[model samples]
Target: METLRWQDHTLYLLDQTQLPLTETYLTCTRWPAVADAIRCLAVRGAPAIGVAATYGAVLGAQKIAGETTDAAAFGDRFLAVCDALEGTRPTAVNLHWALARMRDVAAAALKTDSCTAVVGRLEAEAMRIDEADREINRRMGQFGAAELAQLGRPLTILTHCNAGALATAAFGTALGVVRALHAQGLVRMVYADETRPLLQGARLTTTELAADGIPVTLITDNMAAWTMKTKGIDAVIVGADRIAANGDTANKIGTYGVALLAAAHGIPFYVAAPVSTFDRTLEDGTGIPIEERAADEVRQCGGLATALPEISVFNPAFDVTPHEYITAIVTEHGVLHHPDSQVLHEFFRKEGI
Candidate 1:
């Protein structure tokens, strides 16, 4: 599969505000515009949001150069830009993590150089963050592949949401594992949940899998139980938006239901994500704030559905899956089983996350 690459000094982002109907790309050239896109979900996915925010920081630095003459004023403006982007989407810890790292680099640059040098340094650091995300995605895929191989050959796996190339700089998290499994001839089938309200599973994951020539079965969100019962689903893999120190994961809405069902069926439910998804600052899932989407998203059907004039909709873009439901958490660094803060903090410090 061809990996999607980010444009330098340009943000080639999916205009998610027009998804399922239009595949639009927004080229963000300024920090505020980039932050607004993320807040409005013109660009999404945990890893992708982080990448966008990193680029947004660079754009901020460029904007500062053009707007200010004082070095201190420029640095303050840059920090404010980073803060705004970091808050664009709160569920994804990666957004703040990436931006914070960028701010640190920017702060360091200010101590030893002129304004011109600072801008150049921030640009290079932003590029490093983007490149690192790609490498992490690929390596996480490799780690997840080893775990999937242990299940058996020709394995049937179920997944929810869009966690493929569209979700990250390269490869993906959970979908990356699915891709690697197919590459190794271990996956015989993939069942994609429609991921209602957003239809990321149907619109994004299924498309990517099919593009790779991997057989995919699309089913309504409620059909997961039936598919597992008749098709012998061996495992369930999902991407995490945020992972608490206790191992509880926050992902797309309905993911908790999928995990509960997977446990009932005795299927191993695994979460594949980069180390950046881990939030050591948070003790458990309870502290993670779930993003509630527009009511219309739940009340109405966007594609191929009969229209209803009046209906109340409860739409949450994501849900938290308790730690007990997760069999393992696979990262670019390694795979963790039933992890605790001790293990999580160690990895965070080791990776300087």
Candidate 2:
């Protein structure tokens, strides 16, 4: 199933919050609606949001297509939409990267054309971005599966959060690796962590895997260590929102702890993501900003109160996993055994990335 769709100049996102029970879609015709979807996690995951924002910029351009007689004024409105979408999620570099590409496309189009032409060009670019992402994820899956084969067959894999087809254009990042292996009949089962507060793993990931007829078992966040020790997990593969120059990663909350557990248990911890997820300007994970979500997310589950209202709560959407904890990183370009600034630089140079 398509996680998102474009019809009649509107972006329709699969409402992830209502997963595992009810399936719903949110139709966004305006850029503001797109922003809200991103903020509420309706259209999440780094690559997915990047593609969404690119299309949102196209809608913004459409809104001001005939409003301005001057090209400069039209560019202003388009840039504003990009700026607004860029602010939706700070942890993911893909959001900014996509918007920057849109801006460049807009500038180049306006150099010799009208605002209406720019709108068409933006729409074309958005579609190109979406297709490119799907292809990237597919390639990443192949590369990641190969990486796991080197360690031995990954019969039992453990993953955190929802990184399946729902998380990206089609195949997922971390889940993409699983999908690739599963396609080969190599995967026996997948253990998904019921990410606390949001329960994305329980609601979205398990459902997605089950829909594909893949074996899946759900477990609570705290049960990861026990499961790993007893279940004989072969590998831990997770998605990344941002990667630092040194390979430090920012992913769904509790991933750092999961990585630690895997390392302690002698399980290889692998990260799968597109090359766009890396931020070269950031020296390390310390520079990544963590988005703190609403406290209500932790106080309730499925609209039912589970904790005292007055009790203290700390809800961060993500956490940074130190590079040292990572066994290897799989990207569409290829796999990096262990990445530091110098090695990463060499990789980019070698891959022409």
The reply for model 1, stretches above 4 Å from the true place, is 1-8, 16-23, 303-312, 342-353
Tell me which residue pairs clash in candidate 1: none
* Per-candidate TM-score against the hidden true structure: 0.93, 0.98
Superposed by TM-score, candidate 1 places the C-alpha of residue 217 at a distance from the truth, in angstroms, of: 0.9
Q: For model 2, which pairs clash?
A: none
What tens digits encode model 1's per-residue C-alpha lDDT throughout 7-30? 666767777656555777777788
In model 1, how large is the Cα lDDT of residue 247?
Answer: 90
List RMSD in Å for every model shown: 2.3, 1.1
Best by TM-score: 2
Measured on C-alpha atoms, candidate 1 has an lDDT of 0.84
